[model samples]
Target chain A: MLDHITQTTLLLDEEKCRQNIAMMADKAARNHIRLRPHFKTHQSVQVGEWFREQGATGITVSSLKMARYFAANGWTDILVAIPVNIREMELVNELAAKVQLHLVAVNIETVQALAEALQRPVNIWLKIDTGYHRTGILPHSHEELDAIVALVEQNDMLQFTGVLAHDGHTYKQTDAEAIRTIHHTTVFLLNLVRDRYKGRFPELKVSIGDTPSCSILQTITGVDEIRPGNYVFYDLTQQHIGSCNFNQIAVCMACPIIAKHPERNEIIVHGGSVHFSKDSLMGANGSLIFGRVVELSENGWSEPLEGIEVVSLSQEHGTIRASKALFDRYKIGDLMGVLPVHSCLTADVMGSYTTLDGKRLEHLSGMGQL
Target chain B: MLDHITQTTLLLDEEKCRQNIAMMADKAARNHIRLRPHFKTHQSVQVGEWFREQGATGITVSSLKMARYFAANGWTDILVAIPVNIREMELVNELAAKVQLHLVAVNIETVQALAEALQRPVNIWLKIDTGYHRTGILPHSHEELDAIVALVEQNDMLQFTGVLAHDGHTYKQTDAEAIRTIHHTTVFLLNLVRDRYKGRFPELKVSIGDTPSCSILQTITGVDEIRPGNYVFYDLTQQHIGSCNFNQIAVCMACPIIAKHPERNEIIVHGGSVHFSKDSLMGANGSLIFGRVVELSENGWSEPLEGIEVVSLSQEHGTIRASKALFDRYKIGDLMGVLPVHSCLTADVMGSYTTLDGKRLEHLSGMGQL
Candidate 1:
């Protein structure tokens, strides 16, 4: 199977992926929360089908393009996780007409725009910034929050469903305890907002997402839905953050070693930033690690070899440094599986994937498409 | 025109691109060296045709897949710049049979494999490490260098073309003088190697590349050919390294402002690592700048706005920091052009480009083919 790949190709461990989905879906079931697993990580409809086998129906995506792609493939309910882009109101309306599209509103202007442009009724979630400062209206901004709720209440087409918060700050935590703490505090804040707004909007629920928080929290009390995406295909960043272990990582880049430099003890693989997006995490030694190098075997690969790490990547070449013994083991044309630091960006950069069992999974972010 | 794009799209300034190609082509002509510009930057067949208009007959690519794509598009002379992968011997034979294919060799093992498997003749350039330390055999490694040249000379089908060196170190320097110094030293070292092997290999020539070195050096002597790629779309990194001016940059990502944080003076754009890549460079303030923000207009965009910088990026979201004045000027759905730090990686991640005149240019890196 390894020999058949002539170029840098993304390999998926279907069994591991199934296990990950089962575990996360079971966790959501046990917690009595809807598992609207984010589809932005593995954008493949095939992977979404795996989620369906675990009883997942509703999903979360990062962009309208992804929502349309999944909706075209029969996903009836999809929440575009990011704050609404009013410029794409036409696309939002197109998708809203086809599926139960859920758009996020961070301000009153967005809510007003959606009300005016959306021809069909769509679920609207007010984006709440618990702590992640990247986006969303502050949870403590009562006047701003009230204005969005008031506009949604007046609009017939905009169904105010809930408040959505992505605890993106949890990704910075390096341990399960820290992530859990952030998750608990975030949920408490989001629940406070829910309590304040639930009376006026009786259908309002609470949703919080971020793989590290969802994966580490033992009990998420107030969250009505969990939208963890990276858990489906965890990577070195998640492993470093203590979200998931190495065994649960489902995707790897099978790159052929194209050049060797013994004096520097570095080998160049055909894979690079184009194959694995330039997302890096700190290694155990406190240095930057681009990816973990695993020795490829017949079935898949061995555990990441000790002292072997991808140090740098150019556009089409990855420079890997390993022990002299490991260097001696590989010649030009040998294949090695690189466990990417961040699987979401890796998956998006790869565009598609090949399951170890030989099934090809296609998704959004395909070349030549915007 | 800016209002028409609803999503993140790579915008190419056709006039600037044409000027870039013509300038580099004229420079190569004046220096009496072949201008085999690297096509890995743009990858579009239409962009390649622009080089053809500038009288460029040869091209450089990073992978065999790219070589095949260009070959199919009527590009006759294509050189795969990375170290040769013997696993792609069948591909080398196939491409060599169709076009003037050239492959890079760093060791005798690769030369031997090519000799054993290549049914059709292909040009082979010995890769020489001229202080870049990335790949290639050290120029001081005389015995190893001799063995590769000896084998290629002995083989009937293998054509010994020259010694190829990529002075990637010049990218670290931020001034033209420093880059010119590095380029001069690299050319001197490569020429020394050429003098040593020219007698045994009659076709010995010197080839060196790296956008910074090629763009900064005013007089490139002793080099037979220059393979600068990023000059076609000079980027923020090039501007910082004094390789090209800000106006020479031909590509920028048009990202829609999805969310604005007035409190933090930050605007979130719908472009991230998946679109612009994780490549960054040192800003004027000694901080890592993911990209420079330019105000979008009818024809293209303005210069980098004061105190506006793409500070960080997630998988599909870019968090840009700007002054309060700049932040207030943008609302959700407003478009801003992000000039990427590295245009090559940006172009590859985008997989295509849209000219300011509204023409879409598709390129290599199309999904699933590999």
Candidate 2:
């Protein structure tokens, strides 16, 4: 299989990916919350279909383009999880008219824009920031929350769906206990806001998610839905965070070694930022690791070779520093597998993937727009 | 102009790009070296036409696919600057058969592979390592050098063309003198190797390039051709290296502000790693700047706003920390331009760009295959 790879090719372990999806879906089922797995990670129709096989009906995407792409593929319910872009009201109207669309609104302007332009009823989630501080209305900003609630109450086309919070702070916490704490705190804050509006809007739901929180926290409370995307293909970052075992990483980039530097114990592979997306994490040795090198076989790649890590990356070149023994095992024109540091960005950069069984999976990246 | 930019859009200033090309072409002419600008930066037929307008007959690319794409657009000369991937020898052979193709050979195996697979004469450049330590045969690897020379001499399908050295180490140096020293040292080392082989192959040319060295050094000597790609679009990295001024940055990502947090003085934009790439640099205040925020206008974006910087990026969201004045000037629906830290990676991630005049350019990325 490595012999045929001439350039950087993303390889997916179907069994591993299916297992990861099933585990997360089962977790959501046991918790009795909807598992609307974020489709922004894999962005593949086939992978989305796999979620359907495991009984997932609702899905979440980050862009209007992506929501339309999936909705066109027969997905009935979709959520544009990011704060809605009011400038794209035409696309918003078209998608909402086609499917059960859910849009996020973090401010009165966003809510008013959606309310005024919306020709059909669309579920609107008030995005509340629960200490993530990336993008959302503060959970304690009752004045802003009530203003949005008032707008939704007046607008017949806009339905108050729930409070959505992405506990992105969990990504920075390496300790599983810390991640759980952040998750619980985020859920508590979100529930506080949900309870305030519960009497007025009894159908309100609370959605909180981020892969680290969803994977590490054993029990989830007061959340109506989970939106974990990277769990479908956990990577080195997740492994270092203790969220998943090494075997759970489902995606690896197969790159051809174009040059070997024995003296430096380094090999230059034809995979770089365009393939890996420049995402990195700290390794056990306190150095930055772009990826971990693994030996490739016909079935799949072996466990990451000891002491071999992708140390640096340029646009189309990745430098792997390895132990002398491992360096001697490879030659020029050889192929190696790299378990990416962040699989979500890796999959996004790669645009698509080739399953172990040679099936092609397409994504929004393959749509080919400038 | 920013109203329709609901998502991340790469905006190119055509006049700035044309000026950048002409200045470099004139510099190469004055230095009396062939100007074979690297095409991997823009990767667009329209952009290549601009280079052609400057009388650039030779171009350098990093991949066979790019060579084929440019060749289809009537670019006759292309050097695939990266080390030769023997697995793609069929592609190498086909491309070499069609145009004035040049391939880099770093070791005996690469030369031997090309010798064994070649059906037509192709120019072969020996890639020399002159402190970059990325991917090349060490300049002092006399035994390996002689072996490759011997292989080229024995093969009728291979022509001993020249020595190619990419002094990428200059990029890390901020001092002008240090950059000049690296450039001079690299050229001196490459000349030593070339002089030894000059008696055996009198027609051998010496090629050296890196945007920092090419742009900063007053004089370029002992190199037959220069292949600086990033000079066509200097980025924040170049500005810090003293290669180009901020005004020389021809490309900027226009992204809509989807959410704002006045308390944190940060706004969320639709651009992220997928648009600007994860490359970053240290700001004046010692914070990591993913990109510098600029005010958008009809002609172009204003100078990068002081105290406003893109601090963090996720898959589809960039968090910009800004001064209160800068944050107040924009609302949730407004757009801002972000000057990337590294233009090469940004352009590569964006795939293609839209000019200020609203003309769409096509790139190899638009071909859209995994």
Candidate 3:
């Protein structure tokens, strides 16, 4: 695989990815929770089939475009996790007619617009703000919540399904106990909202997701559905947040060495911000690290090298600060595997991937005009 | 145009872009230096035509793939600015056979590999390190320099063109004087290297490039050609570096408003890392700013909003902390124009563009299987 790479290529380890899927699936099965994993991480139809084999019947995406792509490829059920944009009502109507389209709303105006514009039935999930503060209405804002729910109930095309919240604050925690605490608090808050509406809507469910909380917690208590996405291809940020071990990382960028500066113990590779998005994590020494370096082998890659790290990235160049030993071991034209800091962003940037067995996988972004 | 955008769309102001091109071309003409603008910023064939109208006949790209994209579109003289990756010799041979391919080298091993692998003649430029210290041999390293030059001299397929250096260190400065100082020092050092081999290679040329220096310096001395790319799409980063004014910025992302948070004074838009990228600038209050917000008009976007700025970004959402006036001026479903921090990365991530006149411009990445 290394010999065949002529440029920066995203390499996927299928065995490890499957193991991650099975592990998350088994956890959801043991807790009797529906595992509607988010498809935004991999965004590959071939990888989505693996989830179907593991009994995942529904999926979550971040945009209407992505949901439409998955729907065209035979995915019948999808939950768009972001707040619905009313301007895309034509697309919304088209998708609603084709699949079990689940849309999210945090404001009454959007609900009113959807009620007026929809030509087909769709499930509406109230995007509640648990604590992330990025988007969503506060769970305790009953006036606003009741208005949106009442509008949804009045519309024949809109069905009030449940409440969903993404505890994205888990990404800021580096301790397992802290992640668990945040997860428990989020579930408790989400249950409060569900309990408030149980008298009117008895079958209302709770959906929550975030890789850190999902990967560290032993069991999910209150949520009826889990939508963890990044666990499928956990990255260096996940490792730093204590979500997954280094060996569980499923993707690595194969970048060819383009230049070497032994005097400064720096190696330049063809990978850069274009290949790996500019997401970063603080290193052990308090410096910024773009990615972790690994040695590539025939089957896959080894563990992260001890003292080698990607320090900076330009548009098409990555400067890796390496230890003397590692710098001497590699030369120009050799391939080095770099575990990205954020797998979802990296996969989105690369647009396609090649498996270790030399099979090519397609992504939605790579398919133009989708 | 605003009504036509259903999702995040990159908006290009063609008038501003062409004016930027003409301004730089005029500066190069006045200084008696050739203008081989970098094509990596816009990566559009139509935009390259604008440069051709401005009398630019040569171009520079960051990768072999990009060079091929332009070469197929009738760009005959192309330079791949990064150090040559020997693993891509097949692409090198293909490009060398098609156009006046110019490749850069920092070491002897790559030159030796090029000497052995080439079936066509190619111009080789010795990439020198004046001060940027990213990837290049120091200009004072005479022994290493002489070795690579002598090897290039011995190979019939190699034509030693000259010395090329990118003073990327200019990007770190926020003052015009500091940028000019760095530009002068870089030119002095590049001239010293050119003078060292002047007797042997009498026609050797010197080249230097960086948008901040190229835009701010009053006079350029001792360089045969200038290659600044980002000036074509001056971004918020260039404005912060004192390179170009805010009005000269040619591109802005048109993102639809999805959610609004009145309590926190935050507006969530359908733009994030996947659209605008994660490159940031330090804000006035010491917070990291992903991009600057502007009002979208029918003609084009307004100047940067005084107190509204993008504070945080996720995979598909941008959280903007807005002033009370700006927050109340818009609502969900309205469009906001965001000037990106780094236009090159943003353009590469967006993959396509929509001009103010509603014409769609294609990008190389958007054309799959390049």
lDDT values, one for every candidate? 0.87, 0.88, 0.92
Question: What TM-score does model 1 score on chain A?
Answer: 0.98
Tens-place lDDT per residue, model 2, A144-253, is: 88988998999899999999899888888789888878888888999899999999999999997699988986777788899998899999888888889999999999
lDDT of 1 by residue, B1-370 (tens): 7768988899999999999999999888899999999998898889999999889899999999899889999999998999987888888989999999999988777888898898999998988888888888887899998888888888889988988899888988887788887888888888888999777776788999898887877788888899999999999888888888888899999998888777889889899888888888877788889999997877888888878999998878899999888888888778888999988888877888889989988867643443
Off by over 4 Å in 2: none
Scored against the true structure, residue B354 in model 2 reaches a CA lDDT of 84
Per-residue lDDT for A77 in model 2? 95
Question: In model 1, which residue pairs have backbone atoms overlapping below 3 Å?
Answer: none
The TM-score values for the models, in the order shown, are 0.98, 0.98, 0.99
Instruction: Tell how far residue A192 is off in model 1, in angstroms.
Output: 1.1
Count of clashes, each model: 0, 0, 0
Clash pairs detected, candidate 2: none
Q: lDDT by residue for model 3 over A1-370, one digit each (tens)? A: 6798999999999999999999999999999999899999999999999999999899999999999889999999999999998889999999999999999999888898898899999999998898888998898899998888888888899988899899899999998888888888888888888898889888898999898998998778898999999999999999989999999999999999999998899999999999999999998889999999998997999999999999999999999999899899998899989999999999988989899999999877776641
Most TM-score-accurate candidate? 3
Flag regions of model 1 displaced more than 4 Å.
A367-370, B366-370
